[model samples]
Target: MPVAYNDDMDKRLIQLGAAVIDTEAHAIAALRTRINGNFAAACKYMLACEGRIVILGMGKSGHIGGKIAATLASTGTPAFFVHPGEASHGDLGMITEKDVVLALSNSGETEEICTILPLIKRLGVPLIALTGQPRSTLGKVADIHIDISVEKEACPLGLAPTASSTATLAMGDALAIALLESRGFTAEDFARSHPGGRLGRRLLLRISDIMHKGEEIPAIPENVLLSSALLEMTRKGLGMTAVVNAQNHAVGIFTDGDLRRALDQGIDVHITPIAKIMTANCKTLGPDLLAAEALQIMQRHRINALLVVDTEQRLIGALNMHDLLRAGVL
Candidate 1:
């Protein structure tokens, strides 16, 4: 049976949704005060750690910890999440004296985490705690404690880990970004960690890696007729052809747009030289240029293709927007 819609109920539902977001936003904003000396101290320990930062949490906190660990690992800091419950059952062996342990618990008295506190302390590893209660067992024993308390949860019943989880995740991001800045982590470094992602394609792919080279490039002499250039463009299927001199140096580019303008001007394709119809001093990129930089040039110039040249302006390669799309760099 379909339920009937009530106008008052609809308004109440939207109001409740807005309230939840408002509460969570406030929760996250409140965490800025927690980024004081204690936050810096935690970062210092994690930065000095020779080994990975091992994260431990329970339930919802565990989920946040996993994401935090991933952010740290991708931003030049080596880290991984270890479930506290599993740690007591032998996963604790994953931690070593060289590593730093980061524990998250809203109340800071999680039994599973508390169960292994002695073990972590015995290893002489630095223990950093993120908890709401500074007096809790885990907080008291931590080498550094950064509070992640929220005034209240978004849940009206106040039973769910709503605002608290948001606060914890925001704090985790602050730590990861701070360490990333301190380590001078670059986009290239991040790309190395995410080679299969879009950012990796944009950052790591050079024009040489994706451009059509050698015989695959469409090229002709400057004296060639527009008919010959058009055939070369058709054969190469790049919608464009480079016109070079006797020295194979690119002097101009003849694209579909040039062809349209030539036809509009009643120029005979068979008799007109490509040089007369081609765009002179066309935009070009070097083989060593990044694909992303090439994209910016193409977009800025409102062009669809680019010629790849060497230091001597000799045509070595060619690429179009299609190539960037295929290479996942667009």
Candidate 2:
């Protein structure tokens, strides 16, 4: 036997979920009004810090603090999360006088966090508190206080932390982005921090890094017959080949797909010159451009490959979409 919900109950649950979302959204939006001198002070303290920003929190705040630490660490700031409970045991040694501690507690009264505050104070470390209660002990004791107060919890019973947590997380993001902007963080700098991510591949990988060079490049002389060009395409295994003149300057390109189209028109591959059936205005890229830019060109034209050439229009390398795929840039 199983219990089933009526349509009325189902509608009520959906409405409840929607209300929760709307409430959280409103709370997060309200944070814009609270950004003032205190926020600026927090940023100044962090920017001046010679060591890491040590984040400490408990329960749900701990989870949000962890994410904030990661965001800060990846975006120019060196930060790490330390559990307040663990700090009392041995983690407090990780913090130094040069470091700044950011403590998060909705009530500004987490016993575990407060217990370690005196020890942190003795070491002359600056404290930044994010809490709903500005009048509480933690807020009063910290060097800087960020008010994250919310109108109400989204929970029906007002017990679960919903809107408050969302507001705090939004505040954390605000801090990270503000610091990121002040530091003049560039896409290349971000790529260095996230080398395993797609953005890293887009920013750090160049066309020459992934293009086929030497024998791997498919190329043939302009005087070669269309049949020999087809053989070169087959031997190199790229779908296309660069048609070079006697001076080794690329003049045109021939592809297997183009050969199919020529065959459909009853053209003879054995007798015709390769240039006769080649595409004259083939798309090409410079060896110094980013691989991502090359991918954009190939995708925009709906093509599969491109020839890498120098300013003199001499073929130096070649690449297909598959090359980008293998290099993890696609």
RMSD of each: 2.7, 3.2
Residue 281 miss distance in model 1 (angstroms): 2.6
**Model 2 Cα lDDT, one tens digit per residue, 4-123:** 767998879888999999999999888988899999999999999999999999999999999999999999999999999999999899999899999999999999999998999999
Query: Which regions of candidate 2 are displaced past 4 Å?
Result: 1-6, 310-313
Report residue 319 deviation for candidate 1 (angstroms). 0.8
Worst 10 residues of 1 by lDDT: 2-11
Candidate 1 lDDT by residue in tens digits, 1-330? 966657998879888999999999999989877889999999999999999999999999999999999999999999999999999999999999899999999999999999999999999999999999999999999999999988999999999999999999999999999999999999999999999999999999999999999999999999889899989999999999999999999999999999998889999988998888799999998999999999999999999999999999999999999999999997
lDDT of every predicted structure (CA atoms):
0.95, 0.93
lDDT at 148 for candidate 2? 98
RMSD after Cα superposition, model 2: 3.2
Global fold similarity of model 1 (TM-score): 0.95
